[model samples]
Target: MMVGATIIDIGTRKALEANGASIASGALAQANDASYDIVSDGGGCTDAKFIISGTFTTAPTENTTLAVYAQPLDIDGTNDADAPETTRPTVFVGTVQVNNVTSTQYFELLAENVPWKANYYLHNNGTGQTLSAGWKMDVIPYTSSPSA
Candidate 1:
């Protein structure tokens, strides 16, 4: 039985903010609104692990949560250059809550089973906050048996 995991660098160290724009109160913002081609590395994957990590320069209100969601894209035929359909429904993955504090803070979340070729976003559940640059989200595909 040979098991292995492959780290899919779909997107690394992607900024959570757009053009240094701060997330408004109780707003949902896409992580750069970029579409990742998960099919390249997601083939034969039995499961997927998602990791989102970042620091909040402007800390959110105490006890507030940041929710993560993903929407799968529909590719047209075999042409990768064609624009992907973005009308698909989004699925909730997971969320992380903030502690009671007003200073810069770090946070991380781990989720599983996120769909491939999906675009994800963050929903701010409290007052507006500014995320520091260099925030990242990564997806890791796992195979139960590599030799199968």
Candidate 2:
């Protein structure tokens, strides 16, 4: 679902390229599409944070808000706020807190090579009405090194 999210390295990283062109080349191209390729080290992991910075074809399911959570424990089942650490992973990032405008809403998160879990939930936070339809979270994972 976050396939559309852009990825960046947190520190020292090698130059990235797209196809036969470097990231700069791609950015300079008419299409202007590019990304960085990062490799991880040993047991040590890196941080991959994501921020909501895109658009939705349609409005969200009316009053429905999307919440992203980190669940490193069990891969399945729903999480109750009570024992989130046991059921859910962690609240590395929260929702926009308010309805996202046509502009852009922000949701942040961090990911590591250590099988960190992630999930999104939709709820009607507005009055009692539902949401529109289209909704999506733009994510970007911070990297440590470009080429390991």
Candidate 3:
């Protein structure tokens, strides 16, 4: 059976606010993971889209898609130590490693279902030459689509 094109255009209001940090060389940061928070008036209880863009001093070996997500805990809790929460969510968006490491390159991550959290981390699944520094992320939350 074949279904005709529904001509679907999920018109949802979305907005992205830039709130991130930079990771120093050999410094563990909470922003090095996947997760998002509510940035709209509709509340951060729904899923939203994401578009990650930044500059990297070091380039990843392969194409990596860093998962972006939101958690219910404050993973950035510090115990007088500088090491941030290393155990975060990386299932939403994956960081795609490109070959451009000289200049600022843009990375796009489109998420559907987002939640209200306080931490977003970048998940690293491989142990290659680690990236040195220079990285930032942009988060955009949108209203959910209607269910038919």
**Best TM-score goes to which candidate?**
1
Of 1 and 2, the candidate ahead on TM-score is 1
73-148: candidate 1 lDDT, tens digit per residue: 6645433322222232257767778765555445566555555566666666664565545455555555443333
Tens digits of per-residue lDDT for model 3, 24-84: 3233344634434454332544544455555555664455434444444443553221223
Off by over 4 Å in 3: 1-28, 32-45, 73-97, 124-134, 144-148
Write down the TM-score for model 2. Answer: 0.33
For candidate 2, lDDT tens digit of each residue in 1-148? 2554554545442211112211110011111122222233212334544343333333433334433443233345543232233234344334444343444444444545423433322222331223323333333445543332
**Residue 33, candidate 1: C-alpha displacement in angstroms:** 6.5
How many residue pairs clash in all the candidates, one count each? 0, 15, 23
Least lDDT summed over 10 consecutive residues: which range in candidate 3? 77-86
Instruction: State which candidate has the highest lDDT.
Output: 1
In candidate 1, where is summed lDDT lowest over 10 consecutive residues?
Answer: 80-89
Candidate 2 lDDT trough over 10 residues, lowest sum: 22-31
Q: What TM-score do all the candidates reach, one by one? A: 0.58, 0.33, 0.52
Which residues of candidate 1, in runs, are more than 4 Å off? 1-20, 55-58, 75-89, 102-104, 127-135, 143-148
Residue pairs with backbone atoms closer than 3 Å in model 1 (clashes): none
